[model samples]
Target chain A: MQPLRLGLARGWVTWRSVNTTREGLANTIIWNALPLVFLLIFRNATIPGTDISVGVSLLPGMLAMLVVFSVMGTAYYLAAEREDGTLLRAKAVPRGTAAYVVGLLTVAVLDVAAAVAIVLVPGLFIVPGVPLGDAGMWLGLVGYILLGLMACVPLGVLIGSVVRSPRVIGGLGFFGITGLAAISGLFYPIAVLWDWVQWVVQILPLYWLGLGMRSVFLPAEAAALESGGTWNTPLTIGILAAWAVIGFVLGPVLLRRMARRESGAAVAERRRQALQRV
Target chain B: MATTPAGPAIRVGDLRMNYGRHEVLRGVDLEIRRGEVVALLGPNGAGKTTTIEILEGFRTRSAGEVEVLGEDPEHGDERWRAELGVVLQSWRDHATWRVRELLAHLGAYYAPYATASHPRPHPVDDLIATVGLTASANTRVGALSGGQRRRLDVAIGIVGRPSLLFLDEPTAGFDPHARREFHELVHRLVDDDATTVLLTTHDLAEAEILADRILILAGGRIVADGTADALARQVAGRAEVRWRIGEEKFVRPTDDATAFVRDLLTGPDGAGVVDLEVRRTSLEDTYLEMIRRHEHGDAAAAALEPAVAS
Candidate 1:
C-alpha cells in the first residue's frame, strides 16, 4: 500500500519533469506538430462525393494514431531506462519495481491525455462542421480514448520487457507501429483497400480505436465510408476489451520475469555494449 | 566506540558462482561481524561485484550457505530488503530528479518497515547534509559533477538507515578530496550508527583507511583476511633495514626493527654504520605480494587465518 502511494508520487515527479524539461517539451511539439500540419493542409479539401472535409475525417484517425505512438513511446522509454540503469536502481529497493511500473503507467496515461488535448482542442477550430456543442459526443470521445489506452499500453509494456535492447525498440517498434497504422486505415478509409487487408486490420486494436473515434467525431452519414458501412459500436468495444484482457494478463507476468533478471552487472554490460555500438 | 551486537552481519560458506562453464567465485567463504567495516580487495576479475551482488540478493549463487541479517539472501523478503542498503556503481539513472527528492522517494518504501529501535527513512535534509550534498540538495542529478553525483548515490543508499550497507567501489571515480570526504562519511556512519559496511575497492589505501578488516581475494578465493597491519605482518613478516658503512652499503630484513637497530649499534660495526633507514611493508605491498603468492600457489600464504577465525 505504501509502495502504491510512493508509486503515485514517483509518477507525479516524472510527469512534472518530462513536461517541464526542455528536451521533453521539444519532443512533444515535434511529435504533435507534424500531424497538425497535415490537418491544416487538408482543412479545405473534402472527401470525393461526400460533404465531409478531409480534415474532419482525418482528426479522429490522428487521435488513434497518437494512442499507438504513445504506447510505442512507453516501450522505448522502458528499454532506454533499462539500458541506463534506472530499472536496476528500482530493483534494489523494497517493492521498488512494482512502484516503478506503476509510476511508468501513470506517466504514460497522462502523456497520452496531454497529446489528445493538444490535437483535439485545436482540431475543433481547423476542421469544418465539428460537433462541439453535443455533450454526448464529448463523453464518447473520452470513453474510446480511455478504452484505447487500456488496450495499447500493456502491449507496449510487454514488448518493452521482451526486447533485449533499446536500439531494437527504436527501429523495430517504429516500423511495426507504422505498418499497423497503415493497414488499420489511420490515414485513409479501409473500405477502399482489399477485402483480405480489411479483415487483417480488423483484428488489431488500432483499427477499433480509429473506428470508435470516428463514431464520435464523424456524422452518422459518414459511416458509409467504413468497411461494413456502419460504426459497429459493439464490435469496437469487444475487440478493444479483448486486447485489453490479453495485455493485462500477459503484461504482469512478462514484466516480473524481466525485473527478476535485472542486476547491476547486467545493466553495466548493456551500457558497455551501447557505448561500443557508438 | 559503539561496537556492533554479538552476531554476524553477513555469513557465507563455499559460495560459488558460475556463468556458463566458467566459474567466477570458487568456494569463497567470509563472515562480516555487525558494525564492522570489511573491504573486499581484489584485481579486476576477482569477483568482488559478483560476491556483493549475491549478498544483496540481486543474483543467485550456484552453491553456498549465504546469510545476510539472519535470512538467506536469495529468499530475503521486502522486510529483509528494507534493512539492507546497496550502493551500486550507478551512471545515469535518476538524471532529472533532484537529490533531496530522489532520496525521499526511495526512502518512502522503508516507512512501513520502521521499528521502535531504528526509524526508517532518515530525514532528507539530514541525509543530504550527512553526505555533504546540502548545497546541491535542489540540483537535478544530471547537473551534478561526477563527485557530487557519487555523494548523492551514497545518500540514497543510506536513506533507509540500513543496518547493513553494501557499497561496491563507492569511491572509484572520485577525486582525492571526494574520496577523503567519502571515507570520513563512512567513518561517521560506522561510529555514530553502528552500521556495518562491506565495500569493494582497488584502492589499498582506501581499504586500510576505511575497513576494520581487509579480505584479499585472488583466483576466486580469499587468500588473506585480517586487519591491515595483521595482514601485512602475516605476508611479509619482516621490515627491510638499510645502512651505509664507509663507502659500502648493506641491506638486511629483520622481524624486529627496534631490536635490530639496537644490536647493530652495540655490535663491532656499529660506529661505521651511517645513513640507516627502516622500511616496513605497506598494505599495498602486502596486497600485491599476497595476490602474487596466491597466483603462484604458495601454500604458506594461503594458510593464514581469516578475521573471523582470529
Candidate 2:
C-alpha cells in the first residue's frame, strides 16, 4: 500500500517534469499535429462509393494510431531508462521497482489521453457524421481506450525488457509500428489487402483497436466497408481482451528476469559501450 | 528495535566468483562491524566491484557464505533493503528531476520503515544542505556540474537514512575541494547515524582518511587488513631515520627509530647532528609493495596476514 502511494506520487512527478518543459511541449505538438493535418487534407474527400467523408473515417484510425504509438513510446522509455540506470536506482530502494513501473504506466496513459484529446477536440468540429450526442459512442470511446491501454502497456514492458538497446526500439520500432499501421488498415480498408495479410493483421492488437474505434465513431451504415461487412463487436472485444490477458501474464516474468541481471557493473559496461558509439 | 542483532554488520567466508573460466573472487574473506567505516582498496579487475555487488545482493557468488546485517544477502527482502543504502556512480539518471524533488520522492519509500530510534528519511532540505546542494535544490539534475551531480547521488543514497551504506568509488572523478567535502560528509553520516560504510576505492589517501580499517585486496584475496599504520608496518616493519652531521647527511632504516636516533645522538656526532627526521612507510608504499609481491607470485604475500589488533 505504501509502495502504491509512493508510486502514484512518482508518476505525477515524472509526468509533470516531461510535460512542463519547453522541449517536451514542442515535441507533443509536432507529432500529434501530423495526423490532424492529414485528417484536414482529406476532409472533403469521400470514401469510394460512399457518402461518408474520408476525414470522419480517418479520425477513428488516427485515434487507433495514437494507441499503437503509445505502446512503442512506452517500450522506448523502459529501454532508455534501463540504459541510463534509472531502473537500477529504483531497485536500490525498498519497493522502488514497483513504484517505477507504476510511474511509467501513469505516464503512458496520460500521454495517450493527451494525444487523443488534442486530435479529438478539433476533430469533432472539423469532421462530419460523428454522433456527438450519443452516450453509447462516448462510453465505447472510453472503454476502448482503457482496454487498449491494458492490452498494450504490458506488451511494451515485455519488449522493453527483451531488447538490449533503446536505439533499436527508437529507430526500428518507429518504422515497425508505422509498418504495422499500414497493414492494419488505419488509413484504408483491410479487405483491399491480400487475404493472408488480412489474417495476419487480425491476430495483432492494432487491427482490433482500430476496428473497435471505428465501430463507435463511424455510423452504423459504415460497417459494410469493414472486412467482414458487419461490426463484429464480440470478436473485437475477445481479441483485444486476449492480448490484454497474455501481456499481463508474461510481462512481469520478463521484467523480473531483466531486472535481476542489472547491477552497477552492467550499467557501467553499457555506459562505456554507449560512449564508444558516440 | 531495541534488541538490535549482535554481530558484525557484514561477514563473508571463502567467497568465490567465477565468470565461466575466469575467476574474479577466489577465496575472499572479511568482516565489518556495526558503525565501522571499512574501505576496500584494490587495483582494477581485482573483483572489488564483484565483491561489493555480491554483498549488496546485486550479484550472485559462485560459492560462499555471505551475511549482511545478519541475513544472507542472497535472500534479503525489502525490509533488508530499506536498512541498506547504495551510492552508485551516476551517469545520467533522473536528469530531468530537480534535486529536492527527487530526494523527497525517494525518501517517501522509507516512511513505513521508520523506527523511533532511526528515523526513516533524513529531512529533504537538511539532506540537500548536508551534501552541499542546497543552492541547486530546485535545479534540474541534468544542469548540475559533475561534482554537483555526484553530491546529489550521495544525497539520494542516504535519503532513506539507511543503517548500512555501500559506496563504490564515491569520489572517483571529484577534484580536491569536492573530495574534501565528500570526506567530511562521510564523517558526518558515520557520526550522526552510526551508519556502517563499506566503500571501494583506488585512492589510498582517501582510504587512510575515511576508513576505520583498510583492507587491501590483491590477487582475489585480502592481502592486508588492518588500520593504515598496521598495514604499513606489515610491509616494511621499519622507519627511515635521517640526520645531517655538518655538510654530510646520514640515512638508516631500523626497526626501532627511537633507539636508532638515541644512539646516534648520544654517540660522538650527537651534538653535531642537525635536521633530524624520521619517516614511517606510507600506505601507498606498503600497498605498492604488497601488490608487487603478489603479482610476482611471492610467498610473502600470504605472510602479510590480518595484523588487526584485537
Give the winner by lDDT: 2
lDDT of 1 by residue, A144-199 (tens): 98898899899888888898777788788779878888878777887788988888
Worst 10 residues of 1 chain B by lDDT: B301-310
What does DockQ give for each predicted structure? 0.69, 0.68
In model 1, what is the error at residue A213, expressed in angstroms?
1.2
For every candidate, give the share of true A-B contacts it also has: 0.70, 0.80
Runs off by more than 4 Å, candidate 1:
A194-199, B1-6, B241-277, B295-310
TM-score of chain B of 2: 0.87
TM-score of each: 0.92, 0.93
lDDT of each: 0.85, 0.87
Q: Which regions of candidate 2 deviate over 4 angstroms?
A: B1-3, B236-279, B297-310
Name the best candidate (by DockQ): 1
